[model samples]
Target: MKKKVSLGFKLPAGMKPPEAFELVSSEGADDPAAYLAHLEDSQVEGIVTGMGRRFDVSLISKLPARIKIIATASVGFDHIDVKAAAARGIAVTNTPDVLTDATADMTMLLILNVSRRMREYLELMKEGWGKSLGFEGMLGFDPAGKYLGIVGMGRIGQAVAARARAFGINIAYHNRHRLPPEKEGDAHYFSSLEEMLPHCKILSLNAPATAETKELLNKRTIALLPKGAIVVNVARGDLINEEDLIEALANGHLGGAGLDVFKNEPHFNRRLAEFPNVFLTPHAASATVETRTGIAKRAFENVARVLSGEAPRDLVQAP
Candidate 1:
């Protein structure tokens, strides 16, 4: 008999499951009932999934006894309850590092796009450039020499700092703990997010979604930034309060914003699209072909490790 694993997301082209295990196909999140049924198979020992579905306690409790591990393709594991999986003696892992550069690149893309008013200019070009602007007609700020305060100084945050430095942007970061000098480089460190905000002309959120970080950028925090500041988020969406952000944009408190994620994904407030100063993507920060393929490979490797009675490489919670 062959070991079996279920895939909750479509694998990239030319990608195949490890020969050691048999592949089980299901509708995944598209058809929950069918996906759950597939999980109930006695031979299925592991699962590779994506962020499209939530694996809360209610769902984790229903997992079959044979399921030993749950591997998520994306770096973030907020979609799954690690504690709940741990309670059931199941291991949970995530794909990290593979998508860092891709996500960091997207962060810079959003920063530059928002700073240069690319959304409005792109629209004008698409609509056929009907009017010529004077020197100051649609002016945008230059990122060069501007202060960019990052909320998190992890892998993605450090990558963003490296990219931003090439553009002559000064980097400042607020993390739970300061990085070593070598890793910190010349960037200023702020232990308190509130203390760092007033000096940042450009704010980038690269933190994870946790109890302490959820809604981290509410109205009060947003107010701390200097007026006309540009905001960007390539990390979790719940880090910001959309309603408060919208109010700031409407009141001319913020110059612009670039967002790749939202509190309510695939169903964000339509008003965000209404602002010409706001640029949005459907959480495609790590959507590059290379990154996506790498992430999928990592996910499968994690499952293989756990199924083979070995510890996973990026284990979040192991039981």
Candidate 2:
């Protein structure tokens, strides 16, 4: 007999829940409160969720004792309280590697958007490019032959470097450990972010969110970049200090910025919307149909693995 699991939300198209699982429903799949309420009277052995809900200690304590595993359908698992889950003997898993290329592609798009001032240009076109545009007006920097400093050299960061190399951009990365020559290619490695910032004409944040990484980019750090430097972040919104970034963009210390994630998502900093130099996306870096479906499949596979008395491949570590 196959064990049963519950999906906290609907799976993306082309992906299906495990045949052995029994799906359960709540008033709202994305609501943590609703999920807890539903679990109170449910008999499911496992629950599949996403980044939308908070799986903190409070909520984890309310989960049914029969629930043995939780699978989140995203690469980042900062939203989940892994330590609490582990203490409760509940396994937690995340979908990674699947969204690496998709996120890296979005990073490149942000780089281009900020460096070329694409948002401002598009707005002009939408309002009608009637006025004669002067050559000196709305000039933006070219990324070719410029320095790009990556904060993290993980899978997605490395992927971004590979794409940037084709555009003649010089790559320098700061990571906890340096990569070997083969994996690093022609890229330079820096052990310290402070040492790398001055040389970076363009800076990209790709590090995961943690106590050490949260708000890593702030006023003092932003001041280290070369004047008029461009910034892009496809990583978690908490990685950068929103206030500091806004000040830099407004003061022209930063040439421009492209951000896909915000500290307060869905209700992102409204001040950023007023800046023509700042381009923002509503946290949809991995929204492509193919990538989303892949994520769903991976999350489901994790649930299936644990239910089958096997260890999940993408299990998350306790903090």
Candidate 3:
């Protein structure tokens, strides 16, 4: 008989489970608490989830012992407490690489939106573009010939560099270790992010959120950038201190910002919406049809593999 599995949320179209498994739906309630309540007293061997839920130690301890794997449909596993999952002998898997290009593309979109003041221009158009508009009225800075500093040199960071190069932007990055000359190309590397910040006219945060990275871009770090610098974050929302970012943006210390993620998501700071210099998007960096479908497929494949006495291809280690 095939193993029983429950989906915390509905799968994308055409990404059905294999015949070897009996699939049950939790409808759209993918949150940890709701999903657990839905599966109460059930004997399912696997559960599929996404980044929306918080699978902390408390929740992990309460999960049914019959559950063997928790497959998340996103690249980031920070939402899942991997250590707690490992201690319970429950495997956790994430969908990486599939969303790399999609996220990188969104990063570029943020850069352009903030630098060119697209949000303000769009609002102006809605208000009739004004009859007496002058060329200098809505002038914005061009990214060409500017230095772009990347905080993380991972696959997505490298992909952002490739896209930025086409716009005549010079790339400099700070990572734990320097990349080989072949992989780095002409991009410069800095061992210390603080040392690299002053030279960056446009800064992008692409690092993962960790103990060391949480609130990494606080007031002290923001002071390192040149006055009137632009900041963009496509990574975790916890990376930046929103209070500090808002203060900087208000005082004109930061010329503008583009953010796609937030610490208190779904209910992010309302003050940010009032700032014309800020461009915000609900955490949809990897929202393309193709990428989302790929992630959903990979997540289910992980669940199917683990239930069939096979190791998942994208198993995440405890942090």
Candidate 4:
């Protein structure tokens, strides 16, 4: 007999449901009440969700005993409470590695867009460009020869370094642990973030959202960066303090910023849009067709493995 599964979100285009499982669509799973109701009426042995839903301690505590796993189709698991799920003897897993290149590509896109002021240029084109500009009218920096400081030199960070190197940018990074020489390449490593900031003409955040990383770039830390430095983030939004970043941008401490994620997401701060130097996307760093499909496949594989009494390769922790 096929194991029952609850699908919290629609699959990506051209994707097929996994075999050996009876899938139930749990529409509007973003709503806790609706999701709980769906669970109450179904014997869902596993659940597959995206970051849109939160599986916090409160919700995990109330999950039906039949839930064997919670698999998220995104690399980051900040939305789910892993410890809470583990305590309940439920396996928690996230799709990583597959989205690394896509996310890193998005980071490079942000860096190029912000440094070249593409946001303002695009706006100008939309408004019907009639006026000619002086040579320095809308000057933007070139990435070449500039130092790029990357926080969290993980898979995505290393990928960003490879891409940035192709653009002739110097790479510097800080991480919990230094990468081996082969993976480290020519990128400079910094043991301290504060020491690394002064050299970074461009800064990219690629770290995860954890307690220690929350608001990592607040007023005090933002002051450490060189004047006129550009900021690009393809990581979690909470890694930056929007209020502090806005203040710096308003006061001209920062040259510009490019972001693909926000603290509140879809409901990001309206103040950011007002700035000509700020480029924003609605948290779509890993939205590529190939990446999304790979992520979803990994999530489904994790669910399928656990349901078949085999350990999942990407299990967050043993439950």
Best by lDDT: 4
Q: For candidate 2, write residues 1-319 as lDDT tens digits.
A: 5566666666667766557677675436456666766776666788777677778899898888888898988989888899999999999999999999999999999999888989999999999999977878998889999999999999999999999998899999999999989999899999999999999999999999989999999999999999999889999999999999999988889988889999877789999989888889999899998998898789888888888899999999996
lDDT of 4 by residue, 1-319 (tens): 7888998777778988888798898986557887998987888899999888888899999999999999999888988989899999999998989999999999999999999999999999999989996777998989999999999999999999999999999999999999999999899999999999999999999998988889999999899999999999999999999999999999999999999989986689999999999999999988888888899889989999999999998988632
TM-score of each: 0.96, 0.96, 0.95, 0.97
Candidate whose TM-score is highest = 4
lDDT of model number 1: 0.91
Q: Any runs in candidate 3 off by more than 4 Å, and if so which?
A: 13-18, 28-34
lDDT of 3 by residue, 1-319 (tens): 6777877666666665667688777776556677787767456888787677788999999998888999988878898999999999999999989999999999999999999999998999899875766767878899989999999889999999999999999999999889999989999999988999999989999999989889989899999999989999999999999999999999889999999999987779989989998999999999887888888788878988898889999999996
Q: Tell me the deviation in Å of residue 89 in model 4.
A: 0.6
Query: What's the C-alpha lDDT at position 45 in model 4?
Result: 91
Return the TM-score for candidate 1, rounded to 2 decimals: 0.96
Clashes of each: 0, 0, 0, 0
What is the TM-score of candidate 4?
0.97
Residue 44 miss distance in model 3 (angstroms): 1.7
Arrange candidates, best TM-score first: 4, 1, 2, 3
Least accurate stretch of 10 residues (summed lDDT) in model 3?
Answer: 9-18
- Candidate 2 shows a clash count of 0
